[model samples]
Target: MLIGLEIKNFAIVSNLSTEWHSGMTAITGETGAGKSIAIDALSLCLGERAEASAVRPGTDKAEVSAQFDLSNLPLAHAFLEENMLNNDDNECLLRRVVCKNGRSKSYINGSPVTAAQLKELGQYLISIHGQHAHQHLLKAEHQLQLLDAYAGHHNLVNAVSQRYKQFADLQKEFKQLEQQQQQQAAQKQLLEYQVAELDEFALQADEFEQIEAEHYKLSNSQTILQVCQRELQHLYENDEQNACSILQHSAQQFTELAQYDESLASVATLLSEAAVQVEEASREVRNYTEQADLDPQRLTEVENRLSGAMDLARKHHIKPQELVGFHQTIAQELESISNNSSRLEQLEGEIEHALEDYQNASEQLSASRHQYANTLNGLISESMANLSMENGVFEIALTAQNDRAPNSLGFDNVSFLVSTNPGQPLQPLAKVASGGELSRISLAIQVIIAQKVTTPTLIFDEVDVGISGPTAAAVGKLLRQLGKSTQVICVTHLPQVASSAHQQFFVAKEIADGETFTHMLALNKDGRVNEIARLLGGDNISKTAKANAKELIKAHG
Candidate 1:
């Protein structure tokens, strides 16, 4: 519940701070006395849109701050905890400032917040019903929602919503599959030819590596043979000086010296090892030289094979190494195409099952709503009678349209129909109800739903607009009763309604020092009597009006 509101430099409200109470509180003033300015200021704090124009004529900015007692609201606590904005004290502060340069800033609990965040928080904190709210009731969709809310069918609604989403998702998948099937059909022949061409080569994973090694050998075969022959001659085949011959001569000399000294025996063993290594190197070189092929026909064969592999790689937009995996993918696609009819049949069956589930859920929801609609119509009609519409007929008309598919709300469209008089044809509430009647009807609905609402605060703006005398008194009594469970704030002009407030605020405009501003004060008993008397007698308050005001207050108490 809103505990306090502070508005600065906003329109005619230069600066104002008002404390709100826990029951019905009324803001009353003469026309053009800036009651709307007060409302606008409250709205700003409630995250309503604001602009520089709202700032007072010479002010640089307009600021609005509201304090809410959130000790009992778990949702508020959760939000605070989630945002890490929880305070030691259990109060929530919302503030907004609009600069003259068209910039705005918002804060929650002294922490900077976006307007959207503030708006989200505001939805849970307060609900303001101005004239525009009546228009919301006129929409058929909103009426359906309200009916559902009243019926407490949230779980059923959620189930239907989930099923609808599942159905939509399946339909999307089916459409995508159908498109894929069409595209695959168009490319079937080309894909088959490509696969066959690639398959004809019978390429293996290691074939590319093997071919590369062969290409290296065939490309430099002559150079390799020459290098190998030179190495062999130098190492072992030279007539005079060769590595193996020298090492053998050294080994004999060292063996002869080993008889004279032990160190000479070690040198002889090293020379023998060198001779063996040189002989091995020469044999390897000779074998390589004999095996190297410089034949142009062999080179041409290697080059053509390598070129074919590279060309195939380029055609498939893949590297040679990736060709193996590419073939695997195409093979899978070919298999899928061969079994396309079976796969499609499987998908169709799944879709049919999903559709059946959705249809069944929708039918169940529709039945529940239809059953609840009768009870709802009777309740609303009874509420209307209590609100002084004795002959009023209330109805929930369910129209089933073929074009309207099953939705979370069910398959039928709901419209609220009402007839204010017995002989009159029932029309949509929005089409026929005047402002006063709308106010009463809205009150009736609110009263019926008040028991179900968990929100602590309910604000009613001139809900008693077209009511007076006994009807106005009845509306006042109803608001008071509602206030027993929920905190209600009402802006009203009727004396009877004003008297019903547990706490009353009198809004009056004053002109001081060439500046005009509005002020509000909590009314004392005498003050309230005078104010209500003023409401009863207009500009002049007669002795009889004062007496009557006292009597009304006494009766209300």
Candidate 2:
């Protein structure tokens, strides 16, 4: 139940804060006096899309806050708990702020949340039936949705939709695969030849770099051997003027001088180390000269291998190192195409199974719709009789579209049929009902559906648009009856409806210093009489109007 609403700089509402109570509350005001401003503000808190124009003429933003008592709303409590938006007390505060730049933000319990989250939670909190709700009753789709909502088998309806989607997706995949079968077969043959060619070469990872180094060495074997032999002769093999012999002679002289000067000892040590290093270098060179030998046959084989790899890389339009990765790609494609026929067969079986599942769920939903349609027909028909059309008959016509393909909403085409007079034949509601008759029927249906809903609050924004007099009284009675169990706030112009509410609020527009503002005040007993009198006779109230207003209150009370 909504307990409070605060609006700041929202449209013509500069600042307004008010508390609400359970049971029916009537919002009444003269035309163009901003009667629905509070409703509009509450809608913002309930996650309605915002517009910059909603802001006051000079303000930068508009803000609205709504508080609801959650003690009786376990669904709402569970929602807040699941989202971590719960508070210490059993209450929920929803806030919305809209800026002048057409941007907006939402909050739950002072925690920032997405507008979508607010909408999701709004389902369990309140349900709003706008003034134009009766207009949508003319649409076929809306009729079907209303029937389904009234049926209250959302899980079964969802199951049918899900199964239909699965069936449709499989059918689409099967069609695409069937169309590509011939093209894929042709590509498969070419891929088989290319994969076979790569299979014969069978290049290993990193083998290209190793083989290239080996090929370079074999091609320059003689030069490497000659260089090693010359280095060996200069460093160790030559007896005179050799590097090792010269360094040894220098070390002996330095050693003799070191006996006289200590600094010369260090120089002798360095000379000895250099002689030893030169001897080791000469040994390495001799070893290389012994091992290095040209094998033209192996060289030719390596060169042929390198050339073949390069050629294959060129044919595939890739680098030699990429041959391995490219080979795997083509092989996988070939394998996939080879299995296309088998996959197509598998998809066919799956599509058949999905169709069966869809049909089963759809049949179940159809049966549920039929079962509940009778209940709705009886209830709405009874409701309409009380709404001034005593002879009016309401029925839900369910026709099976067996010839049509399966769809998400199942296989039934639903129509709301009505007969307004005693002798009239049942006809489509849109074709048979007058505007006033439609409004009454719409109200009846809304009342019926609201009874089945678990939402704690229901707001009717001028849903009593077309009817008046006794019929209007009936509409108010229905709303007030609903208010007995759920909170109802109705924006209405009829005094009959206003008097029917447990409480009444009067909205008035005031202009001061060239600025307009909307104000709402809760009406007391005498205030309600004056307001209802104003509704009865307009701005100029008469004694008779006040007397009639009092009588209305007394009768409804």
Candidate 3:
């Protein structure tokens, strides 16, 4: 239930605060007096789209916040707890801010959140029926929604939707498999030939690099052997002027000097280490040179291997290093082509199973909807009779369409047909019902559906729009009854409707500081009488109007 609303600089409402209580609260005002502004503020708190124009001309931003009592609204509490936004107290605050630059922000329980979350919480806290809600009844899709809502078939609808999704997903997989089969079939011969060619090459990992290395070694064996011998001679075997011989002479000179200065001993050790290292290096180089002789037979074999790799790589439009990967890919493609028929059959079988599941769920859903259609028609017709249309005939016509492809909502088409006169034949609401009758039907449907709604509050923006007389009284009483189980707030102009509110708020416009402003005040009993009397008598309230207002109030009480 909504406990409070605070709005600042929103349109003409500059810093308005109001406390709400349980039960029906009627908001009354003259035209252009900002009754709808209050509803708009509530909608802003409920995550409606905000525009820069919503801010007053002199203000930089507009803010609207609503407080809800969560003590009895279990669904709201669950939502808050699930989101970790629940506070210690059994109350939640929803806040919205709209900047003059057309930016908007939303909050729940002082925690910043997205507009979608606010909308989600708003679903559990408030349901609004605006002045144009009657036109919604003209749409068959909306009628179907209304029927399902009234029948409390939310779970069934969800089940059917889930089944449809399963079927759709399976069908998508089947189509993709079929397409893959067709594509692969067209390319199968080419792929098989490629695989055979690659297999004939018989490429192995690391063979290309190893063979190249061997080819390099065999092709340059004589040069390598000579270089090795030259290195060995330069290091140690060259006469007198080689690096090892020069180092030995320097070591001798340094050793003699160190002998004279006591550092000569360390230099002597260095000369000994240099001679030993040179000898070992010379032996290793000689060993390699002796083993470096070429074999023409092995050389020819390596050249043949490299030539084969290059030719095959060129033929396949790839480098020699990529041959292994190309071979693997072709092999996998051949395997898949071999298994494509079996895979398609597998997908088809799964699709058939999914189709069966979807058909079962949809058929059950259709049967349930058809069964509830009669009950809903009877309830709506009776509700219309209570609203003073004693001859109203309502029918929920369900057409099972076999040729129509199953959609997310199932295979049945639902249309609402109505007749407002005794001898009239039932026709579509758009073709048959007058504006007043539409309003009544809309109201009757709302009243019937409200019983099944778990939301704790509902707002009606002058549901009595095209209604008056006894019918208006009946609408007001129906709202009051709805308020018995849910918090009801109605913005209305009719005294008959306003009189039925447990609480009343009178809205009026004021010209302050040369700017238009809107203000709302909670009306006490005396104030309620005066407001209702004003609604009855306009600017001139007579004793009879006051008396009639008092009688209407007393009767509603």
Candidate with maximal lDDT = 2
All candidates' lDDT scores?
0.82, 0.92, 0.88
TM-score of each: 0.80, 0.81, 0.82
> In candidate 1, what are the lDDT values of residues 1-557, reduced to their tens digit?
88999988888788788888787777777877865565678688777787879888888999999999996898888888898888888899999999998789999999998888887877777766674566688888888887777777788888878888887787777787777778888677777888898898778888888988998988887787888888888899999899999999999999998888878998889999999998998888888777766789977887887888889999989999888889889988887875766777777888778778877777777778888889878887887787788888889898765357656666778888899997999898877887877878877877666556667777777666677887788788888888877788888889888888788888888998888888878899999999999999988999999999999889867
lDDT (0-100) at residue 268 of candidate 3? 75
Q: Rank the candidates by lDDT, best first.
A: 2, 3, 1
Lowest summed lDDT over 10 consecutive residues: which window, candidate 2?
A: 286-295
Q: Highest TM-score among the candidates is held by which one?
A: 3
Model 2 lDDT, full chain set: 0.92
* All candidates in order of TM-score, best leading: 3, 2, 1
**Which sections of candidate 1 miss by over 4 Å?**
180-189, 212-304, 310-357, 360-364, 399-403, 423-425, 430-435
Candidate 2 lDDT, 1-557, residue by residue in tens? 89999999999999999999999999998899999999888888888899999999988999999999997888888989999999999889999999999899999999999998998889898899999999999888899899889888999999999999999999898888877878777788889889999999998988788789999999889888888888888998997779999999999999999999989999999999999999999988888777776789999999998999999999989999999899999998888876777889999999989988988898899999999999999999999999999999999999987667989998899889999998999999888999899999999999999999878889999999989999988888999999999999999999999999999899999999999989999999999999999889988999999999999999887
**Backbone clashes in model 2:** 0
Clashing pairs in 2: none
